[model samples]
Target: MCGKPTARPGRGRPPVYCSRSCQARAYRRRRQPLPAPGSPPAPRPTDVRARQRRRIAEAVWRIAAEQGLDAASMRRIAAEARVSLRVVQYHFDSKHALMVDALRLLHEENERLAQGRIPYDMTEPGALLRAVLDEFLPLDEQRAFALRVFTAYYARSLTDPVLAEVFLAAEQPLERLVADIIGVGEAAGSTAPGIDRVHEADLLVSGAVGLGLDVLHGRRSLADVRTVLEYHLGRIFPDAIPTSRPNPA
Candidate 1:
């Protein structure tokens, strides 16, 4: 007998398989013998749950950015992901959990971008700062969408303790990285003396966040934001030699 349990009675013969597919699979297996012990195992199937979760998270981010965080409900996310509502619920217990997961995904993406862009050598602090800060700028459609979602989530975190904890935890690594860069520059004599490394890092990060919001809201163009960021970097690393500025177009 097939192992799967049968459904409740429906005034018909009791079912031996859950469905036609299962019945056919059992028949095929019965007709074939198992492979030899030394034979290589079958390849593992792709992880559907992980794939579904990622799909759902990406959908949530797009909806949050385009329509605001409040619009990113489980039902809406399911619709956007082209999955059933039940599938979304199966992946996440609630909307809050989905949001937290989506935020984590966004943070991971930001970290990837930062790691890829930041130079291995920290001797050039001005260039290093520019590279690090550029990761947060909304210079393209993808970055702009990410910024919008991050800002929306951050604003929500102000009133939600759980989100606040998650957000603050995610921020720690970037702050530490910035501080370390500043320290390295100071050691190399490329940064201004007597600078409060931690405070400067905080200010730099806060400035980037503000500038990203401004660009998202069209308060300033990306080029203008880049110029402002360059000016701020100059102030922080006054001793560092200036590099040729890029054309702001």
Candidate 2:
């Protein structure tokens, strides 16, 4: 900026600007990479890519939920997502890769949203654990859609090794999280003594999954499932207390 020779600092990166004022000016210029004033903003390459990818994944989820996985061909997914077949092919090498990525994104999104929905005032381990576990059920429209998609993929995974790998990869970690919370509740004297949290986690998680499927199949009512869960909770933690929360449905 000054057009004057400034000696480089010994043994360090060379300066881009001669002085702090020059550095600030350069920063201001770089900060305006998008547009000047109020002209229509330019869509960033990375943002557009992410949006497209998410759109494709969401298309997979919706189709799997409403229709069936059989309907989610590459061409169909591209049409559903409003992208070209070439774009879908470009992002995912094959339909299997696309389905796997969509499942992975679904799990990541479920975990993020579930954690975010936890009550900030829920300091109790039992309460937090219940909150987390409740996410597995098809209680409301959002969770119902999620569980619907999950169940469809799970059924497909039974015969597809690639899909099985994806399911198994994410399953154990979630069980461990539940067991850890149960252990905390036990240590805090809010749960029954001498409980094997790992075993409990396995049974609890498996049972919840089974019940969720039942609910999805219309074999059980939402209230009935909640009642069953509460009964089981009472059996497991006689001293555990309840917290005021929104309807799980």
Candidate 3:
């Protein structure tokens, strides 16, 4: 394991040891039998279950996005996933249960993508806030598909109490996060003075989502949405410069 430099070989055989001590150590290691590693770790029941659940949820996402929420029936989901109906039932007991699980998984996936794009220790809270807002745009197919399905779920939530509960559960926490970021920027003197953090955050966050939905439905171009947000964000931070950093993933 010592990474010391070794003597060069004379073009015939390779030399691995630079000195007698290393040679001795290598020899001893070669002679001594290593303990058997046994077998690779088996998949835990929970892990297998989670994986199965994820596959089913992704099927739901695709079907919901391409067709509609009403089309994502339990049997259709099973067929889309190429699994038996019983297997789908085993993983998700009912269509309502499946829809909830799929929505949660979608949020987890969206968070994972944003986390990957934004560094955890990004120093500038303003930059962090900007990135978070930018993520709502449908800059690429993956996000566009996600937003499409999410909009369908949102419409369904209007009549479905269960779905509305899921949406509300996530919305408050997200608004609080955006507000916290704005609070940090305000403390750093980067944001406009005398602004209410929670109020500003609510407007910015909801506005971004509203813009995204419009863009998703072809009512407004993505560029137009960007321009509008830029104007608003510039007003909030007059001293800050705006950059069009499109994440086309």
Reference-based lDDT, each prediction: 0.81, 0.81, 0.81
- Clash totals, every prediction: 0, 0, 0
Candidate 3: tens digits of C-alpha lDDT, residues 68-182? 9999888899999988776687666467989998998898898889879875443577667777887888887888998988888998999999989887786677788878877
- Candidate 2 is scored at a TM of 0.78
Considering summed lDDT, which 10 consecutive residues are worst modelled in model 1? 240-249
TM-score ranking, high to low: 2, 3, 1
Candidate 1 structure, TM-score to reference:
0.78
lDDT of 1 at 218: 84
Report the C-alpha lDDT of model 1 over 142-240, residue by residue, as the tens digit.
Answer: 788888888889889999998898888998877788888888888887777678889989988988978878877888888888878888778778865
Residue 120's C-alpha lDDT in candidate 2? 35
Candidate 3 stretches with Cα past 4 Å from truth are 1-42, 120-122, 244-249
Off-target runs (Cα >4 Å) in candidate 1 are: 1-46, 239-249
Give the 10-residue window scoring lowest on summed lDDT in candidate 3: 240-249
| lDDT by residue (tens digit), candidate 2, 1-249 | 557566698988877666554555456557666557988767886797799899999999999999989989988999999988767876676789899999999988987888787653435776677777687788678888998899889889999999899877987787888788887777777777678899988898999888977888899986778778877676667866754555544
